[model samples]
Target: MYQASKQRYETMPYRHVGQSGLRLPAISLGLWHNFGDVDRLSNQKEILCGAFDRGVTHFDLANNYGPPAGSAERNFGRILREELGQYRDELVISSKAGYYMWPGPYGEWGSKKNIIASCDQSLQRMGLDYVDIFYHHRPDPDTPIEETAGALDLLVRQGKALYIGVSNYSAEQTVAIAKVFKKLGTPFIIHQPRYNMFDRWIEDGLTDVLTQENLGAITFSPLAQGLLTNRYLNGIPADSRAGRSSSPFLSPENVEATINKVQQLNQIAQNRGQSLAEMALAWNLRQPTVTSVLVGASRLSQLEDSLKALNHLDFAAEELAQIDAIVGK
Candidate 1:
C-alpha cells in the first residue's frame, strides 16, 4: 500500500564500491538500534519508508542486531512483506553473521558451520530468498581465515548472498582474508569499519589496504555512536542514549571527555551552514576509499538530518585542519 517517491533517485548520489560493479548510496541506513522487538513496529516501518523514499537503497543488519537477537531482522521482514516488497530489486538489503546468536558454541564466530547456519537463519528471519550482501560481523581470533572465507564463498555459490564483506577487521586481517577471497573467486566487495571524526583507527592503515585491494569501505558509526552529534552539546538529555543508565558504551564520563571537542567542531559546522552530524558524515565520505557512510537513526527527523549532509559534502582545507586539531589529530 506504500508508494515510494518517484523522484527518489534525483537527490541521492551513488558511488561504486571500490572497483566492484555494485554501487551503494552515498549514505546507507543501518538498523543497529531502535528496530528491535522492544521498539514499536510502526516507528520502525516509518523510518524504513522514510529512508527508502529518500533514496536510501541499502539497509544494513546483523543477526545480533536486536537486544533479544534476530528481532531486527524479523521486524524488517514484516516491513519488507507489507510495504517495500515490490521494490526489492531496487534495494540492496544486507545482513551480517558472526557474534553470538544462540545458546551454544555454534551460535558464534567464523566457523563454516556458524556462518552458514547464521546466514540461513538471517534469511529466514528476514523472509528473503537471498540478501544483496552478507558480512561476517567480526574477526574470530581462533578460526582459520580460510574457513570463514570458504563459508562466504559457499553462500554466494548457494545463492544465499550476492556479495560478501567483513566488519571490524584490521588492516592486516583484511589483507589476509582478501587473499583467500581472491583465490576462491568470491565477490568479496567491501569492508565495514567504525570510522568518524573521533575514531581514526581505519586511517592508521585500513584505508590504504582497501584502496590497494580495490575493495570498498563502508564506515559504520559515522557519528561516533552519536558522540559527534548535537545530542550532547548541551549536556546529555535523560532521553538520549548516553544519558540512559542502560547504555554501557556511551557513558557520562565518555561525554565529558569529548564534549569540549564536540562543541568546537559544532562551531565549524555552523560556519559551514550544516549541523555537526552532517559535517561528521561528510568528513568520513571525504575519503575516496570510503564508498559509503553507514548511519543509524531512531526517528524520521534524524534520518532527514543525516541526509542533509550530502548537501554540503565539500570541505575547505582549513576546515579539515581545524577539525583535526580539535579532535586532537
Candidate 2:
C-alpha cells in the first residue's frame, strides 16, 4: 500500500482559484505526452504516485491527450481505482474536451452535443462520479458561446463537474463566455493557456480580463516544452523530447535561435542557485493571477528537480533585466 506523507501539503504552497474557494498546488502534473496508450502502464502509475507523494494533487488531462485518444484517462482510471481510491477527495482531477476527438461530427469543439457527450465519455473512462474541474478544450468559432456555456452549466447542475474552465481562449472570448457563465450562475473558475518565458500571449490581454473577472489562470507548458530547461543547452539529446519527439511546437528549427536564449537564462538561474527548469516554473508562479504551473516530466527525478523552484522565487532587478534582454517584449 502506498502511504502519502501527511507533511506533503506543508512543503508546497497552494493558490486559490480566482475568487473561488478551491485551492490548487503551485505545481500540477500534465498527462499530455508521457501517459498514453503506447507507454507502460506501470511506469505511468509510478509517475502519478510519485507526484502525489510530493504534493502534486492536480493532474491535468484532455479527452484527446493520448495517441489513441482517451487512453490517458483509461490509464488514470486504473490508478484511481487501484492506488488512489482512498485519496480521491484530496486530489483535483481535471479533463478537457475541445480539440478533435472521435470520428464524425459531435466529437469536437464546444457545442452542447460535444461538451455533454465528451464529459459523459470522460466520466465513463475515469470511472468517477464527477471530475473536480472540467474544461472546454478550446473556443469554437462556429458554435454560439452561449450554447457552450450552457453545456458547462448543465454539467455542474447534473453533478458531473464541480467547476468549469476554458482553455486557449483570448481575452475577448473569455469575457464574453464568462458573462454567460455568470448569468447562468455557473462558476467560471480557471483558464488554461500556453505560457512561459518565451511565450507571453496571455499577458497581451487575457491576464487583465482574468484578473478583472476573478478567474484563476493556470498555464500549461511553463517550460516551453523543455526549451527552458538545461536539456537543450549543448545539443538535443536523442532522448530529449525536442530531439526524439516530432512535435511541431518544439521542432529543430525553433531550437536553433532559442539555444542561445536558453543558455543565457541558464546562467541567470545558476546565479540564483536554481536550474533553468526551476526558474521557468517559478517565473509563471510569480504571477498573482497564476494559480498553478502545469508541468510534465518523463521521470520522477525531473519532477523533483522542478519543485525546487519553490525554494527561491524572489528575483533581483538586474536578473529580471538580464532575462528581459534575452526575451524582450
Candidate 3:
C-alpha cells in the first residue's frame, strides 16, 4: 500500500481547474518522456511515488507517450494496481488519444470510432474502470468536430471517463469545440497545450477563450522540453532529451536562439528566488485560465525541484516585463 505524505497538500497550492469544483495541484507530472518500457521499472516507480509524496496529484498521459507506444500507460497500469489502487480518489489520472496508434482507420484521429476505441484501450492499459479525463490528442480537420464531441459525450455517459478535454487546439478551435460540448451537455474540463516562457502561442488568443468559457487550461512542456531549464545553458548534456532524441522541435538552430533567451530568463528567475525551471513553470500559471503546468522529469530529484514552483508564485511587474522581452513578444 502507498503511504502518502502527511503534508502533501500543505506544500502544494491546488488551483480550481477553471470553474469546475475539482482542483488540481499547480504542478502536475507528465509521463510523456519517461516511464517507458525501455526505462527501469524501479526508477519509474520511484519517480511516481516521489511525485505523489511531494503532492503531485495529477498525472498526465497519452496513448503514444512511450517509445514503444502505449507502454507508459501499461507500466502505469501495473503501478496503479500494485501501489496506487488505494489512492485512486486522491489522484486525477488523465489520458489522451488522436495520435497514430494501430494500423487501419480506427487507430488514429478524431473519428467517433477512434475516440471510443482509444478510451477503451487506454482504460485497459491503465487498468482502471474510468480515467478522470479523456482527451482527443489534437484536432482532425477531416472529422466533423460534432462527431468528436459526441464521442466524448458518449464516454462520459458510458462511465468510461468522468470529464473530457481537447489538446493542441487553436483559440478558434477551442471555442468551436466548447460549443459542441455545450450542446452535448458534456463538461469540457481542460485544454492541454505546449506553453513556456520561450513559447507563448496561447497567450495571444487561446487563453482568452478558455477564460470566457470557464475551461481549465493545463500547459504542457512548460519547461519547453527542457530548453527553459539550466540543462541547455552551458551545452546540451549527453543525457538530455535534445541530445538523445530526434525531435523536430529542438534543433541546433532553435537551441542557439533559446540559449540567449534562457540566459535572460535565468537572471529573472534568480531575482525571484527560483531556478529557471521553477520560474518557467510559474510563468504559465500567471495566466488566469492556467490551472496547472504539466512537467516531465527524467528523475525524482528533477520532479522534486520542479514542485518548488509553488513555493512563491508572486511576480514583480519588472520581472514580467523582462520575461516578455526574452520571449520577444
Candidate 4:
C-alpha cells in the first residue's frame, strides 16, 4: 500500500516526442546500471517508486540491461506487479532489442527473427502485454535496414509495441531506417543516443537529421557515466562505478583523463546555482530535437539530485560557450 504523492506531476515537465502526440517527462529513469538481480529488491523499489512519486513517467529498459541479461526487466516486472500495478497506464515503458541476449545467430541484432523473438522474450520477462515504445538497441551492419525497420513496424501491427525507436544509430543510419519506417507507415518517434558534456557526437549530424526527419531524441549517458557530475571532482571514489563495477563502460583512466574539464565545469555550474550534473542534464535538453534525457541512479539521493536539474534548464550564451570551450567541443 504505497500511495504515490498526489503532487507527483506538480514540478515535472513533459516534452512532446518529435511529430507525435505522445509526451515524455523531461527527465526519465533508465534501468541500465542498477535494477539487476544482483542489486537489492528493496532499494530498487525505493528508487522506482520514488521516481514515479516525483513524476518520472518514462522508464527505459533493454533486453541486455542486466548482468545476467534479462534480470533488470524481470526485477522491474516484480516491482510493477507488487508496487505500481495500479498506475501502469500513467507510465511510458520502453525496452530495446539488438544486443546479444542468448547464444545462436538469432540471439542478437535487428533481423526479423531476433527482433520479434526478443520482443516476445522481453514482454514475457516483464509480464506485459505490450510496451509503450520498443527500440532496436543498435544498428546492425550486416542486417538490412529494411528488415530491421520492418520487424519493428510489425510489432506495432501485432499490438506488441506502440511506437518504434532506434538507439546507438549514427545520423546516416537513422535516416536510412527512418525512410523505410515511413514507407511502412510505422510510428517511428524517438532516437536514443549518448549525449553529454564529455560526449557530444550527436551534434555532429544526428540532431540536424532528427529535426529534418521529425524524430525526437532521448539522450543516454547525459552525465557521461557520472563524469559530468561531482562524483569525480575529488577523484573516483572506491564505491563509484568506475572504481569496481564489472561494467567496462567507464574506467579509472577515463575518469583521470577528464578530471580537469570536470572541475572547470563544476565551477561554471556553481556560478549558475546548479550542480555539474544538473547543468549536464540541462545541456542535453537544450536541443529542440531532444525530448528527454535518460538517467540512472543507484540511490534515492542520487535520483533526487538528478531531479533538481529541472529547476534550472536554461543556460546563457556565455555559459554555453564556456562549456563548449572546456569540453573542447
The lDDT of each candidate is 0.93, 0.90, 0.88, 0.93
lDDT of 3 at 70: 96
- Candidate 1 versus truth, CA RMSD in Å, comes to 1.0
- Weakest 10 consecutive residues, lDDT, candidate 3? 244-253
Query: Mind sharing the TM-score for model 3?
Result: 0.97
Candidate 3 lDDT over 1-329, as tens digits, reads 67878877777888988899889998899998788898998889889988988889999999998979999999999998888778999999999989999999889999999988888998999999999989989999999999999999999999999989999999999999999899889978899988877778898899899889999999888887778888899877776667766876676667776787888888888888999988888888888889988888879998889888878788888888878877888
Candidate 2, residues 190-220: lDDT per residue as tens digits? 9999999899999889999999999999999
Alpha-carbon error at 219 in model 1, in Å? 1.0
Q: How far is candidate 4 from the true structure (C-alpha RMSD, Å)?
A: 1.2
- Report the Cα RMSD per candidate: 1.0, 1.3, 1.3, 1.2
TM-score of 2: 0.97
Error of 1 at 24 (Å): 0.5
lDDT of 1: 0.93
Cα miss at 292, model 2 (Å)? 0.3
Candidate 2 stretches with Cα past 4 Å from truth are none
lDDT of 1 by residue, 1-329 (tens): 99999999999999999898999999999998899999999999999999999999999999998767899999999999999999999999999989988888898999999999999999999999999999999999999999999999999999999999999999999999999999999999999999888889998999899989999999988887788988899899998888898897788888999999999999999999999999999999899899899988889998998999999999999999999899989
Q: Write the per-residue lDDT of candidate 4 for residues 208-246, one digit (tens) a residue.
A: 999999999999999887898888998989989899868
